[model samples]
Target: MMLNPAQARARLRKLIRGEERVFLFLDYDGTLVPLAATPGEARPSGPLLDLLARLCTCPGLRVAVVSGRGIADLEKLLPVRGLYLAGVHGLVIRYPDGEEVWREDRAGDAKKRVEELARKLEPLLEGKKGFLLENKSAALALHYRLASPREAVEVVRRICEEARPLLREAGFVLRTGKKVVEFCPARANKGEGVDFLLSGWRGAFPVYLGDDETDEDAFRAVAEKGAGVLVSGRPRETAARYRLAGPGDVALFLAEVLQDRSPDG
Candidate 1:
């Protein structure tokens, strides 16, 4: 059962009411900001940053931007203080206190393999317009959002076929999103990242918001401890306990939270 806007807002308010500790795990693209034709065009509004900063300042509340983007990229884009940044699907986590943690020590080899796969896929998608090969250093994403449906499907099939052997040898896994396919390290996922971020905060509740299939793992992770808000215009098979229409709705929800000055209410 997906929650409507009013119901979802009321439910979220109740979830955080009088809570001593809260953790917010938010996805960047498509959740905080609308999905852009190119990744570079996706940018959060200035007010959004101010709101997030205010949220971070609230007592006993910790906020984290957990996205598939690289840590450096996220740092450059969202310069909010007093927040955590978990990048590369949680492969790397940077704490607000200047501490950092990484999942594996063999990232060098993994990234090389990912680049190799990208190279192999380039020729396969040679003439396809709007086919973007994004290398996040820790993962590779094939974005065909602007391509025609037929071309997207064909590109995906050919990439899957050509990269199978490389993926096998590197023990990598493929994750599908809205018109995008990602090759990531098998051991690192959004779920594991959420767990890592929540470790030792046994009593604290979590609220996760995401908009893509890649976020399903984080949704399931938060489901055990708190709630997951799926930001989509339509209902779909999801582990999220609630749903919002889109980024506009998400901003409104955050604004409500910001207006609630009392943290222990």
Candidate 2:
């Protein structure tokens, strides 16, 4: 069963009260803001920015945005300082102090292979209305959220048929999310990213909030030591122990976290 807002708040407060440090990991697109038809349309609002800034300032709390977007794109979308960013599903991690780390992949030609895949897929999707080919440097995503249902089905079929062999040869993986399919390096995933971040702060209480299939790895990563809050309105099989209705509820819960004034707060 999912915890309601009040229950979630009380539970979190108790956890925060016990921990010496708290680490909050957030997924960008669906968790922090509503999912947009296009990636560019999902820019953060001023209030959300303010809320994040306040959370960063909260004592004994650490904040990071772990996203499928590249670090450069995340930097543009979320300009809040003092916030760590893990992009390309944690292939790249940037610290609040501007230090950055790139996870080494076994495939030395991964970038070249990714570029070639993009080149091959672009033409396939170009004329298909509402199909967007988004190249995020380290990964390529085919967005069909704006396409008609029939068109979406056809596009996904074509992609899987055409791209699967190449992906297998290049050591890449395909991930499906809400109305989109992503071709990314096989070694890069949100779980490794969450584990990487958690490694830096020993004994910290960690809480992650996300709303997609891609986030399942992260949910499992923190399952033993922390809480994974799934943000969705509908019921589904998930590893997450808690759930919030939507981004609006997420903001309210975050506000409660910021307002808590216990000794560790």
Model 2 TM-score relative to the real fold: 0.94
lDDT of 2 by residue, 1-265 (tens): 6777557767876877677789999999889999998999998889999999888888888999999988899999888989999998888899999998878454347678888998888777767899888888778888889999997998899987899999999888999999989898986799899999989998888899999999999999999999988888875899988888788888887887787732345
Residue 227, candidate 1: Cα error in Å is 0.6
- The TM-score between candidate 1 and the true structure equals 0.94
Kindly give the stretch of ten consecutive residues in candidate 1 with the minimal lDDT sum.
256-265
- Which parts of model 1 have CA positions greater than 4 angstroms off? 261-265
244: Cα error in model 1, Å = 1.2
Clash counts for all predictions: 1, 0
Q: List candidate 2 segments past 4 Å from native.
A: 106-108, 261-265
RMSD of model 1, in Å? 1.8
Tens-digit per-residue lDDT, 25-143, candidate 1: 99999999999988889998899998898898987788899998888889888899998999989998889886877886788888898888888888887778988999988889988
TM-score of each: 0.94, 0.94
